[model samples]
Target: MIIYDLACTAGHRFEACLGSMFDPNPDCGCGASTSRVPSRLNLGGAANAGPGRDDMPTTWHGTGQGDPATLKAWHGAMTKRERLEERYPELAGDRRPILAHEGAFAGRPLRAGDDLVPTVAKAAFGKEES
Candidate 1:
């Protein structure tokens, strides 16, 4: 199935799913026939490449290798967030800290939904437990 925007003779616009590309127009809510409308292909804005009002491709091609000096200068010109994302694309939308190893718990202890091993609270200068 393919989704397409359609407009009725009565000026109603809506989205519809057609079984085939050549399928007949579907009826609108007001019982008027709807015709397929040309939709815009909107690929969202790209990230800024430098301090100026410049745009950069959202994706890279090939091995993404470049001359050390040139790449260092380009990287230095990017914002902190851009630099972080360029270095770790996999963590683009994640807000948590990246850990080198697995965590002790799968999630926050309060929301782990498992019995937690309680730790004993001790005084700062208290004797060590035998």
Candidate 2:
């Protein structure tokens, strides 16, 4: 079997296995079950050059890097939450309410302030004055 990095139209990327070089049904791991395309392979440069090349590819190198946007979003969310807690001690003191409310909002799609970033923003600025 061969593993390949597959990316869907929705930008969901994942690994897939093919029984052989001719096996079909390769697709992305998205919940929609879309067909996958071979983005890259691990032939160790043998597929590109003849034997005894001075610049042979190394096998120990890492493969299948992740999407930068997804990683940036995750880091931004964590940083926003941390900043919120530091700025508002009262809100940090009571996290259960914030988490519960944010969780409920996150269940809905195409909504704002549903994730940790917006949740922290609301906690820091959306509260009504007593």
Candidate 3:
């Protein structure tokens, strides 16, 4: 989506998001016609290619290369487990401990119902696991 700063005939200014810059101006609340104007978003920034942002994509966790939701869920589960263990030292649980190398998806331990990343599962337990 593209956002543009627009000005109406009545001198009112507002921003609108459009699928393309060539789209017609949107109606203003003042019942006046509007025209697209220059904005900072169209300037040189995140949307444009640059020396640092042009680097090749990577494929690892902790390096901006993996699925963010999976990574977040994994860490959330790990943090919850840690808090539980801290609150209840004598709580009865499996001795395996939450280990990432066992059945983790991204970089954290897998919970009771979490599934591993497809490639990671296949790599850890062959194609059948995937």
Candidate 4:
């Protein structure tokens, strides 16, 4: 059997046990039984090209536009934020204060009611002054 770090659409992360390489229905451990496996990556066999294959986009490393790791981290953070908002509706509007106080967006000018753009752009582009 193999253990995999599984995440649900609700952004809940948990461990899953697979009996074989082809486990049809992996449980999310979040009480929601679904076939959607968010964290499984095919990394073996003839159909798979192993790790770090050329088929993956090379622009991140070669062109210095953006890194895939950073993008994935940002995506994870966003997912968690969405989950938190869903869990606590009262805290949904409280995110603005956190974003404003975050060091990444400190000193960045906000456009009237739009405060998330600076934080998002800084996180995405790695620009401290964005």
Candidate 5:
């Protein structure tokens, strides 16, 4: 199955998996008929090509790992977070991890009820971790 970007007359956009020979037209969540929309080619890296727009990038090679010259220039001039915000303006002031960097778990192994939400919540509210 191939996934294609689709949009309805009402301006809703979504994706659907279809057979190669199957009709491209599909119904949108708003119940409006949809048509195929232009999508970017994803070479695969992180973040699933991001909304499939021409202006948006399909891959992100992290903040300090893209071009050698860019990295060299940013070395003493910008922090990783600063560079990230510069590259992706939408993420400005966002305090979430750009990518998964799961550090080594301490103490006992996590049980079924364990999760990382509290850790995030604590940081968000300025509460120190227990």
Candidate 6:
């Protein structure tokens, strides 16, 4: 999928995710034909930096790892609540809440309901162990 920034003849500006670049122009909803306008995408640390666009990122490294909330923002996901619901569908809308850090499960394998704290993990498991 691709997001196209479109501007209508009636002066409406909007974006839509379309299947292909060659796909027919989508209606601009203002009874006018929309034209694909230029936009910048900053994904995986690469972006189109050209004369028309500002906000050129000077420094961006590979993937980042830190607090779960920051990671969620980097993942471009919604709030912690929504991500947890998506990852654990049965727990959706639970009156009880799970914080993002807790959801990380501290490097444990996913969906197994088993985890270990750092100190305990170092003591009980070895590097070669799965």
lDDT of each candidate versus the true structure: 0.59, 0.52, 0.63, 0.56, 0.59, 0.57
lDDT by residue (1-130, candidate 6, tens digit) is 9988999999999999999988988998878998998897666775422221122122343223355555555445334445666676764533333233333335533232334355344434633234
Scored by lDDT, the top model is 3
The candidate 5 region of ten consecutive residues with least summed lDDT is 49-58
Tens digit of per-residue lDDT, candidate 1, span 1-130: 9999999999999999999999998999999998999998768977653342133223343214555665565456555547666786863544444332234432332233222233111122233334
Off by over 4 Å in 2: 33-130
Per-residue lDDT of candidate 3, residues 1-130 (tens digit): 8878899999999999898867888999999999988776544546421222113234484435677776676566556656666676554255444335453345544544445465456646656451
Better model by lDDT, 2 or 6? 6
For each of the candidates, give the backbone clash count.
0, 1, 0, 0, 0, 0
Give me the overall lDDT of model 2: 0.52
CA error at residue 125 for candidate 6, angstroms: 49
Residue pairs with backbone overlap in model 3: none
Between prediction 3 and prediction 5, the one with superior TM-score is: 3
Q: Lowest summed-lDDT stretch of 10 residues in model 2?
A: 48-57
Q: Name the top TM-score candidate.
A: 1
- The candidate with the higher TM-score, 1 or 4, is 1
Once model 1 is optimally superposed onto the true structure by TM-score, how far is the C-alpha of residue 52 displaced, in angstroms? 27
The TM-scores of all predictions, comma-separated, are 0.34, 0.24, 0.31, 0.24, 0.30, 0.32
Give a tens-digit lDDT track for model 2, residues 5-120: 66767777777777886776545555545556667666675532112212222333421144566556545655665676577565443333333434434553223334666655
For residues 82-111, could you state the per-residue lDDT of candidate 4 as single tens digits? 676577675454233332434644666333
